[model samples]
Target: MKNKIVAALLAFFLGIFGVHKFYLGENLGGILYLLFSWTFIPGFLAFFDFLGLLLMSDQAFNAKFNPGIPYSVLDGSRSAQDITVALSQLKKLYDQDAITAEEYEEKRRKLLNEL
Candidate 1:
């Protein structure tokens, strides 16, 4: 919500520089906007982004804003011990048939990749 507010205010005042895009966590978009703003593209883009933020549904907003950052690792990436414990629990759940093989494999893959 705060990001949206910042984007709105930036759009109102500095839309030409695409500062609004940066506030919305769009680094690439912000860079593009910054580079081409003087050509009028970013001004038009910022106007649309502003309208989208105001009128778009939550699902769309989430889809757009989702960095997919894990809350579990917010304090810093979880230690290997933590991942090991989680993987062990998942193994037990799979063995008990509480979760499907596909789910188990998917989670295992994610955990391995984290290491």
Candidate 2:
């Protein structure tokens, strides 16, 4: 997960080169920032980014940078590791005939869809 403080710091310091953009997975933005750093446009934009980061809510930040990952997964309520283990166990049960084919497919689909 991307931390707001880290992003803000990078924007404030190395934003001329778009370090925060790279950190946030905006590779194209980062490259553009690097390309235009001499022009000072990226640095100007970075200042606004720093200000925006300061004003953004944690939930909004997560929704933007960490899409597709639920808070529960981050909090360990139900994680990808747990899901993977469950899938392996479910496959074993199915292979051993502990579950019928239809039941296995239904359960597998439900688990996979969560990922």
Candidate 3:
């Protein structure tokens, strides 16, 4: 779970090194930033990133960074529905014999406990 404040801080401070890009899981963008860091382009880009972070909502941030995962800001955690769906998928895998029974049981217990 990445924090907006942390990403903004990284952009403000170490964005020249593409730290914020890496933090956001944008490896290609991070590498490009690194390649052009000496040209001051990354600094300018980082400034824009800082502004973007300030402007972006938490839901937008999560959607951009976390992708398919559903996040619940009220509890600062994943939604129970997502966990249940994952458990159901795990069961399907187990039924197909894709995973050992022991593995399925362990994962099922872990997922249930998360609820």
lDDT of 2 at 81: 83
Candidate lDDT scores, in order, read: 0.76, 0.91, 0.88
What lDDT score goes with residue 91 in model 1?
100
Sort the predicted structures by lDDT, highest score first.
2, 3, 1
- Which ranges of candidate 3 are over 4 A from the true structure? 77-115
- TM-score, structure 1 vs. true: 0.48
Encode model 1's per-residue lDDT on 1-115: one tens digit a residue: 3345566678767777878877777678888889997799788877877776767764455556654534355434787987998899999999999999999999999998888
Winner on lDDT (2 vs 3): 2
lDDT of 2 at 79: 72
State the lDDT at 115 in candidate 2: 78
Task: Give the clashing pairs for model 1.
Answer: none
The root-mean-square deviation over C-alpha atoms between each candidate and the true structure, in angstroms, is 11.3, 8.3, 3.8
